[model samples]
Target: MSSPATTPTAARTPRKAALASWIGSALEYYDFAVYGTAAALVLNHLFFPTETSPGAAILFAMGTVGVAYVVRPLGALVMGPLADRFGRKFVLMLTLFMIGGATFAVGCLPTYDQVGMLAPALLVLCRVVQGLSAAGEQASAISMSLEHADEDRRAYTTSWTLQGTQFGTLLATAVFIPFTLLPEEALFSWGWRVPFWLSAVVVVVAYLIRRHLEEPPAFQEARHEVPAGQPVSPLSVLLRHHRAAVARIAAAAMINTVNVVFTVWSLSFATSVVGLDRATMLWVSVLANAVALFVIPAVALLADRVGRKPVFLAGVLGPAVMMYPYLAAVHAGNWPLIFLFGAIMSGCLYSMANSIWPSFYAEMLPLPVRVTGLALGTQIGFAVSGGFAPVLASAVAGPAGDNWLGVAVFVTIACLISGGAALTATETAQKSLDEIDALHSSRTEAAELQALGTGQEPAAGRGAEEPAASGAGR
Candidate 1:
């Protein structure tokens, strides 16, 4: 029997761990959503000069939003190995500080008046850092939460990390409402800066909570039992063994495009093309997200009972269907229809993927390579779809205006692709950590057998029969 000293105190604090993950994720996404809000409402007017047409200026500001997504996959590539090898907690804290500091610096940047061409350039630099910070935040938090959770309860626990994201959106949007009420001069001059500046304070508190966290027992055990031969890097193992799994994950992650469409492009569309009031559009976001606060957790509980795929597919299908009515309402400038369709599309429907993707995406890979695989696949996919999607949606809106039908079709097809890819994945809801982790277990067992032949007690212990290939069906 193991001694009390060997008992994993980290796994014992699942609730605390989940709470910490929730708060940190909330703060991280709050910073992101704040940037998005700024890009939509004020960025064109503030950072970039108005000598450019408003249309061209908005396009450039929106493109800056995509810049972060562009860097996210690179961030994942750089940070995933560190999290996999070092421990999730340290990396989580590092990402938090980087994101918070970068966001705070954004508030401090000069406008084109003071800095000329250099102003937008500086803003892009800060956004790139924020994007890199974001790349690892969700993946690391989910990995730690998953490792600390009970086998049956993993989905429910991991769902909280995503729940935090909804709260962040709510908070970010709420902060902007009062600011939007300001006169155009005041709103652009300083009102938008408050939310970004507040990120620093939240980061300090979240960092304190996260710094105390210990690595989960599963990760600690794997780290404890290094193989007898030369150690392999997680990157090499991921490429050689889990190539197909990563591709599938990236494919399924196309769902992020749907999210970007709802949050970013749709807002820009309603305001610019549809001529909806800025406050009206902002309230739609706040209310829909408020409803989603409850919706996301409930959907996740159901996922724990049913399966990740069904819940996520329902999420994908609902929004794909609703994407039509919601945009139609925006085109009509009908407030009630806009709120009704918008709430369901964003709050109830889109949230299905929001609640479940943390657990669903993480479960696709075995533990040893889980962080890198999840980060690489999801961030890269998000980069291609979510990152540049707003620019695409804007172009699709076309020179004729409010041609949202094209953009709506773009979003629907993306959802169909992600949902179809999800169908090909295993139903991991009922599986244990060890069962979900097949490839690593097989290799460990093979190493243990080799150790036993040398008359050394098996250092890593035995595992299930090895898969014929790393990407073979679980």
Candidate 2:
């Protein structure tokens, strides 16, 4: 049995896991976000034949970008259960390879002018692979870190996973800024592909770091206790005992609309609609993400102290209120105002919720179902919010489209939905990893007892009864 003497060592393990998660996530998402940047500015021009309708072409390019999200949940269904049953480390390593290999291949694909329809088809295939990898990446990384974390500091540790994503976005945009400044003739031909090709370097580095990571203690305990052949199915476990948490996470994930709007829709809106220079918008994204790097960890620390809900609530609501002003500033065509808005909205305001989500979401479910619950819930919600955001933004701002107000309203509604979802979740800030599972178990049992009293069958296949008052702190 694990003992109290092991606590200090276990605490240090999460730090190492956090470091690994940060580096791996940074490398993985760099490949993903750079593709989005290229889709907005370069892919439409290169992958599709020139047509009379440039706007329609851009929309088509973005649709291809969104196609990845459609594949994400499918990937999650396969990988999530595997992560839960096998280990976080195994799934993470596989995800990195998939994303890295697909991204590198995309860099080398022939253009539409050369390969005809085959170019876009190849692009979609690579994107599906990337999406599959990404589907398991975030949840598995957070689970690895959070499961290793000292209970009191779980939010802080898991938040670093999110910080890594922002770092990746910042790094990708920073790399692209210099490339975007190249002459147009050069940019479309090869400049954009440089970022994709750089994935080779990121993949090698991430692979080296992730190879050494150990499985989390929670998973180890689950492995030992559960019978070898009677392993719990992640989907069945979630559907029976943790369905409410999954529902709440899915709803809260709609808050990703804020990200889609800021990253994808805004990139297109600024470049295509507002006539801002592509490099300028890229720089704005870089600064905002740079700010997020700091803000995410800091807010995560705050959540550790004050509670995840309040920090998350502020994060959820902040975007709703700020969207109008931010877009108005963008509409005014002032670079300084746009910079300030981007930094505050994405960097400071959104970072609050963004930072805490990795921990907050993981805490809601037990260890056995954690990866599946998170992957399925967040990806499904993200697909709805993120996949359609660019398309919706395009429709809202039709030809001669300058309606920033309508776009702002759309973003605010997404924020409100996520905020309400956050408010409905139980506060788990003070709970330890072991206690989280137990607490959920107890609450589940209580609900079942109430149902039994009313002559209803207790929820089927609920886990064996949790011992009462068996709490453990970080």
Candidate 3:
């Protein structure tokens, strides 16, 4: 019922939500990415005793990094329904507190020398907490932003949430550069803890910004439309009506593998195999992320004008093609080439997909199930893509190996799968947010009507076949 004039004003809600989403996502990923940086460069040395087989120790350390992702699906199942039923703001707040608290706890955990094997076990427990919080954070934030966005501008506005994530990555890498550069003795004992402890500052700032946000109006309307005591369940509705959307989202979600490989595995590859200093890889991460801050918003603007699918397709295809050259540069020990590859692949090419996904994924669902569908679908897909990317990348590198071709092949396949998924979705850029659910409802009703008139039974199987069907087409 929001008019075009009022719709513009309502869209301002996304801008507000974007601000909150940006800060919260920035803080959360800062904590998370810092851990990845450490896992790649330092954790094995600190947690595992110096041994002849340093590669195995590094692999074990990276496994710990992947452990958090193992908990993501559970977090999605628990928190997705909560966001759908309660409010986006509530879930956002809960995730921020959990991520921040757990990150801070990681800083305080005793090293292996102090606590023996118990130290790594405790580290994994805290990581699970971080994973659970993260599972719902991006989805909830995107839902909040997308629901508040105006139709034509949705991609641009929601892109800010993604921009925040890149900012977090940049901040995380920037923070770790100095720590990694510290004298080995200092870095081993206390310097690594500084980045984790810094989560306290990010958490405090994000909490204050998010506390003032209001729930999206679409959610408010959905609450009114559903019958009282009818046990409205977003998951149930999503499974029943939005199965195609879920599949599309999962396929599109595979693009995250590009990010995880670059962020986690590249760091390890560059430092361990390519013989680049750990500090150099961290600097590359910082620069790539800084570039992403601008590239993401620019690609998002282009998506709004040209349509989401084309922009998304370009993002997906660009990375697959670029993966070989990028990995090869690192293998050849070309610093300039390494920076160029990172900037283009991670910063510019991948940003095209990263920036637009908040709007693209949210648009695939109706207001009632938007949060649950986005969270569950993306998190489930990300479990395979992001969680195991490091392990896969390591496996490809093999024993006594720095196989850049193998890494490139792995990255290319993931990107192609994501592109194929994007091609299957309906174009939704021109439609209003509030009308999306209604439009979908009308389509469903019309399809049912046409089936009945053609002598086909309705799929739902309970309603009066004639009047309801006739009225639907009208």
TM-score of each: 0.86, 0.86, 0.84
Clashes (backbone N, CA, C under 3 Å), per candidate, total: 0, 0, 0
For candidate 1, what is the lDDT?
A: 0.80
- For all candidates in order, the CA lDDT equals 0.80, 0.80, 0.79
Preferred candidate (lDDT higher): 2 or 3: 2
lDDT of 1 by residue, 295-403 (tens): 9888888998999999999998888889998989888899999999989988998888888988988988776667888899988788778666777888888986588
Worst 10 residues of 3 by lDDT: 465-474
Q: TM-score for model 3?
A: 0.84
After aligning candidate 2 to the native by TM-score, how far in Å is the CA of 216 from where it should be?
A: 0.7
- Deviating ranges (above 4 Å) for candidate 1: 1-10, 40-60, 110-118, 180-191, 226-230, 391-399, 402-406, 439-474
Task: Report how far off residue 372 is in candidate 2 (Å).
Answer: 0.4
How far residue 163's Cα lies from its native spot in candidate 2, in Å, is: 1.2
Angstrom error at residue 110, model 3: 4.0
Q: Tell me the lDDT of candidate 2.
A: 0.80
Tell me the spans in candidate 2 whose CA falls farther than 4 Å from its real position. 1-12, 45-60, 112-116, 180-191, 225-228, 266-278, 391-400, 442-474
- Against the true structure, what is every candidate's RMSD? 4.6, 5.2, 5.7
In model 3, which regions exceed 4 Å deviation? 1-12, 40-60, 111-118, 181-190, 224-227, 266-278, 390-403, 442-474
